[model samples]
Target: MSKNIIITGTSRGIGFELVQLFAKADYNVLALSRNSKPIEALELKNVIALSFDLSKKDDYKKVESFIGSNWKQVDVLIHNAGTLLNKPFVETSMEDFEHVYKTNVFGVTELTRIAIPFMQRTSHVVTISSMGGVQGSMKFPGLAAYSSSKGAVITLTELLAEEYKETGPSFNVLALGAVQTEMLEEAFPGYQAPTTALEMAQYIFDFSLNGNKYYNGKILQVSSSTP
Candidate 1:
């Protein structure tokens, strides 16, 4: 049987491109995003686009039901839904930090817990992080909330990998560099990234499929640019 994959943040950017790559490869893909219209519009074969909000507990039920009904086993779970906060440290509020963590950190944990039951030892969990989240990486002034949340998930991924080492599913995190996506454009206007979303997504597609063979609980720095 073809591998069953679940990818979040699929409305656009890397997640959007990843879904198409998997679909073209004849893999079964479940694309999750708050705005599923773009993927639904495409009507790609071997793919199901669902409206999913990572922060909403109710939305997770949609995922559980789908997996329970159709795909009893999941091969890959990619956490790509993240929110960005461009405000300065001084301007950032508690609510701001909570909101970012909701999707980036908490949502990842919750979804992984839910997916574990359906994943075998061969399944792979790929979490998308940011270059800014890596310790000693170049620090940006206005991304305290966003960067910090990304950092949290890195540790979370590590802990999960260790805890499940003796289990079936393997977990890993990728600290990525700037990719020219709408999120980056919104956060930093006109700052052209050396990489495009599709390019990065292709790299992730390959990694998710085979990275588990070599590494688990590893943080791979996938960056060519600093900012």
Candidate 2:
């Protein structure tokens, strides 16, 4: 049977690339994003476009509805929808921090929670995090709120992995470094990004299907130089 994968933020960038790759690999894909319009260029069978805001609480219900109307089990869930805020720590407002956390941390957490029961045993949950989650890299400045939010996501990934250690699905986070996406453009205007979305998507797809149990609960870093 073909694996069923659900990818968020599929309107563009890494998420869009992932949808294409997985669909090409003969996997059933449910692509979710605010822009639910179908991409005529990606005319692949076994692919469905879903519209929902990951930052909102009601979006989980929309996901549930989609799943209920389609597949029975989810083989993989990729949390790729995230927001980045760049400003001095002193200038960062509480609202900005809350907004970032809601999407990066709380939203992801809720989606994973709702997806657990629908996921099959040994299913994989891949969260697209960043090196910012680990440490504030020098390339970008005044991103404390975004970095801190991703840090929470990393912690959540570890805890979820441990919680499901006995019988639940596997959880992992990808700490991507400088991927060339809209988020990067928004974070650092005019700066050249080191990684491409297609490359990162391919790596993520390979990692998810490799069935390497050891990767669970670990943060895998993806850079152009390091495979």
Candidate 3:
């Protein structure tokens, strides 16, 4: 059987582009997203697209069950599913914070927890974060919840890498700069980004293929500027 990869948020943007890249490379991509239409439209023989909202515990639990039963080994697991809340800290409510964290942090944690048992000895776990999570960066007014959750992602990735050092899988996070995606448009509105989703996808694809060999327990700052 071909090598397997599990990636979240494959409906569009980086996740969709990643499925294309990996599928072209002959890797069996277990693509999970909230919508099945886009995945089905890909028509790639190697891609297995499952539709489920990552933020919903019940929906993600189904994913855990499917993977546990069907997958013997996962080579790479990319946590790319995330939500953006572009509201001021004062306006951000507890429910808003929980909503953002549910998908960006909690869902990722739970999915990784379930996937750990099936990961290969050299497996790599990559989480896509944001430059907004970086400290000392220009504080954008409307990203309190979003930025904090990504900060949690960075911390979570570090801890997991150290905790699993003796086990097998290597954990790392990419603190992405502005990338041209729907999410970017939603957050930054009218601002132009230096990188495109496809460009970022290529970088992530190459890293996912070989990053674990050289880097582990690190936060890779992937941005064009200090943004």
Worst 10 residues of 2 by lDDT: 218-227
Candidate 3 segments exceeding 4 Å error: none
State the lDDT of candidate 1 residue by residue for 1-227, as single tens digits.
89999999999999999999999999999999999999999999989999989889999999999999999999999999999989989889899989999999999999999999999999999999999899999988899999988999899889989999998599999999989999999788999999999999999999999999999999999999978
lDDT of each: 0.94, 0.83, 0.89
RMSD of each: 0.7, 2.3, 1.2
lDDT, model 2, position 158:
90
After superposition, candidate 2 runs with Cα above 4 Å error = 38-41, 135-139, 224-227
lDDT of 2 by residue, 1-227 (tens): 89899888888899989999998889999888888775435677999887788777787898888887788788899999888888998898889898888888888988888889888667999998888777544344688888888788888889988999888689999888887888888887876777789988999998777644667788876654321
Q: How close is candidate 1 to the true structure, as a TM-score?
A: 0.98
Please state the error at residue 158 of candidate 1 in Å. Answer: 0.8
lDDT of 2: 0.83
Runs in model 1 lying further than 4 Å from the true structure: none
Model 1: lDDT equals 0.94
Candidate 2: residue 216 lDDT (0-100): 74
Best by lDDT: 1
